[model samples]
Target: MNQNEAVQQNSKPRRVSKKKGKALNNPPVKRLLLPTVVYLIIATQIPFIVTIYYSFQEWNLMRPDKGVTFTWFTNFIKALSAPSFYEVAMNTLILTTSVLMICFVCGLLLALLMNRNFVGKGIVRTMFISPFFVMPTVSGIIWKTMVYNPSFGFSAYFANVFGVAPYDWFTQNPLLAVIFIISWMWIPFFMLILLAGLQSLPMELIEAAQLDGANRLQQFFNVTIPHLVRYIEVVVLLGLMFILQVFGEIYVTTSGGPGFASTNLSFLVYRTGFQSWDVGGASAIGVITVILTIVMMLLMFKVLRRMFKEEQA
Candidate 1:
């Protein structure tokens, strides 16, 4: 019996190893993935390579005579030194952070509310998620015209009803307006992710907490939040990536506005390349934006990891 058991254990490892080897050496899988890999390289990497090349050159479309000379870091220096660049960078940071916080909080609340059994829940969820389906440009236009138009829109109607002044959202508070619109649009996305997380949470854990004399808030903080950490990380990271590149709304609403107040890095890149015709500068900014994105994502991962470890401990 002992020898039979030993033989079975030895054969099991061999079988597992063989499976792993086959998976690793699978020609069919490699063949299937080859086209996708090549397409990704052609579609993404080639443009990035071209952008890097342009960043080292002094290319201004307006100055055709000067014609793309390799200036090597001049564009980087100018991009870093420009006063408007700092404002745009700050705006980008503020917008990304504000939207994330708002979305996270609102989404969590909504998720919690929706997680409970209720009538019309499906319709409510569908309505909540509907905004996410709207195009960014359409969202911007809707808010700009129907909601925020101080003269004849919803704001005006509300202000008149309350006998108060209609505030010019885009004009007086362009960055805040952009933040609000973005948060409104993204909250549903965050809610969807968090709802999935909430639903997947083990009911036994909640029951255990309750039996241990834990109150609702205590259970929520000690149990629910910890369980949702991964979902939160996913929501935050994805939101950060998309929010950092938000341009359509900004373009439609403020157009980077009364002097770069609403200009993010993405909008700045467009403004530099298309409007200002500074191709080199735009390329440099684009590279910098990519670096910033990677660093921020790394830092977020580190912070979340530490939090998760502490929770486990």
Candidate 2:
């Protein structure tokens, strides 16, 4: 065979191999991902766009005769100008913050406890996680009637034993009641995440810290906490997102009363659109809520990232 003919044969095999390599590397990834991307945009973004469109128009279901009219920013202005808006905003902040803090502390403690070996540990962990599996509305009802009820409930029974009046939780402390109920439901979620982080932690580090004259608290604060920083960030951010949108607990327990005392932005949207029949106002409030959530999450992410960098440093 001629040298050129042999070289051409080798070159052809190399070219074929290159094509195979490229196919493996690319793997039709875009084709596989396009359906999911399209699905998400249709499910989430399209509705949001429709909401934004409606927010710019005045549409009251009660006054269908007047029909929808483009009023630019009037709906936003009206929604923002309402006195209850600020109160509801504050309630949302307070509820989310309180729940996140409560759940974090409780979850960390539970995770620490669960990380230890003990008899029936699996059963104990299952019991702890059971609340998270319960439906939100069911959890609300359970707390409202079984735990927080002023009469013939745990509160009343305990109050009787203590020789004090059963506190009307939903009436006098509606926001607090909502906070407690939400914390109860979400604490397990944080526990599972934090527990996973704890389990993944290297025991050698703890032993090394101990050899260096570190106590349990010192090791936890210095070694364990720093190690679990990423997990903590994930738990806090996820908790913030879900807790901020809390509606079921408030609805079942306080009904956003006494007179909007326990109402958060989510419940406010429901009340606006459903009760008041003001679609434009509700859409505007929803848009404001989405904006606020995005801003808050971005700020939080920046802070967490900075903290993570510091931990790495």
Candidate 3:
């Protein structure tokens, strides 16, 4: 019996030998990781860093005669001097905040509805989520051609039925038009994330709240909303990031204008860099965008930390 016990002990799995353990972190794996890391640095990190560096210069990206001379914030000064910059910045911020607010609120309601059991739920979920799966470019094109076309759009058809004008959208209130397009495209994403968060919440807590005389609103406010705060932060931040990056919608729907009316910072960057090939000014704008994003992220993180700390307490 002792020998059998000893044999059983010996039969238990052993840790890998030092050589094998080291081999597990093999050179081949390191080699593969190196290329990916390098690619990321080259494709994203390095270019971003270079853009920041060039934001202080006056190079036109084409004028070899001007070359790589630093002008010590003069590029940024020029960017700030552009009359359209401030308006575009404000428009971008307004669009981003408005889109996030509407999408998140509507998403929460839709997600709550989706969480409940119902017939044809799967198909319904797919339908609701389909917008998020569609490419941004495609979404913009469809909205531009099918939904906002004053002459033949769905809106025009409805307006004609009601004896009202089709009401040209992009030509008039272009900012509102862009916001609607961006919000429509992003609402599905918000719904998916919020729904997952809602479904993953602890059921016992909810039931306990109910047992303690909490009404639906009370339970949601006291328990559910507090619990979902983290997920809510993530959704808001993600929405802001994506919305700030909105260019295709602008490109397709309004081309950043009947004038500069619909131009956001991203579109501004595109116009400066590509359309006019003012690389220095574009880099400056890019740097400003990066700074704004970082500021927003830091602010959100500070708020998030406070909430989580309170949650832990």
Candidate 4:
């Protein structure tokens, strides 16, 4: 054989190298996600665990020397047996349920109205959404001092017009007053969510309903609302979480009274932890609040899942 032919025959087979994946899947990717995981654990998870632990103990800032030794549900039992606890629970549920209803109905109305072609659509939408931006503390004080104060508020002005007594807001009706303030603050959020949901819905369905002899009310009930059911449910769930945990409003307006009238569970926790200085009971309430929020979120997720499944099937 020629030398050139021998060299060609001795040539090694070509080996192909596999492509490396585009993204790293190990510590680098995890390094990016790790901060968030760490934050969640530190900011939320660990504190929650500590709260649960403290719930079963008896500790007050007044007596730090006294370690938070476990008392095994004594605080929980005491909370239950407190007469005001029952009243406050009822008031809390009422505030949660009523304000949610008001927000839903009024918000849906405002959202539907804004969905129509209006000259000042942008302004109206902004106005509707503005209240949600107000922090709870600011909103609470604003309502208490500016809007509901019998001496200087709109109520007082109107009372003068009619030559009637200037009725006190928080003093006379604490539950209703707090509910109105909270509802006012939260309605904007509801409106924005529902309005977005309504806008995203297919117009063809609405037109089809109209063509099928459905009047305005009929179309709204049969078409628009059915499309918004999940959105509304989610909104209500979120609102319930907020309302159940309302404290700033109670603090600013009623201070949990005229007599525990506006004292929701959150305020009860605050009162116990700070005013009465019972950290253990406060921790128990915190644990309960977390559980309530979790349970509500779970229920809402189930509802959304069922809705999704029905849509898919």
Residue 53, candidate 1: Cα error in Å is: 1.2
Q: Tell how far residue 43 is off in model 3, in angstroms.
A: 1.5
Best by lDDT: 1
| lDDT digits (tens) for residues 92-208 of candidate 1 | 999998899999999999999999999999999999998898999999999999989999889889999999999998889999999988988999999999999999999999999
- Which lDDT value does model 4 have at 66? 88
**Ten-residue region with minimum lDDT total, candidate 4:** 12-21
| lDDT comparing candidate 1 with the true structure | 0.91
- Give candidate 2's TM-score: 0.89
Candidate 3 structure quality by residue, lDDT tens digits, 16-69:
355676555343667779999999999999999999887877877678787877
TM-score of 4: 0.85
| 1-313 per-residue lDDT for model 4 (tens digits) | 3566556545422222334333321226576899999999999899889888899999888788886688999988887788988898788779988998999999988888888896988988888788888988889899898889888998899999999999887878989998899899988899998998999899899899989999989998899889998888778877876777888888888899988888988888888899978889899877776776677678678877776666544
* Clash number by candidate, in order: 0, 0, 0, 0
In model 1, the Cα lDDT at residue 30 comes to 72
Candidate 3: give its CA RMSD in angstroms: 6.5
Q: 1 or 3: which has the higher TM-score?
A: 1
For each candidate, the alpha-carbon lDDT, in order, equals 0.91, 0.90, 0.86, 0.83
Clashing pairs in 1: none
Question: What TM-score would every model get versus the actual structure?
Answer: 0.88, 0.89, 0.85, 0.85
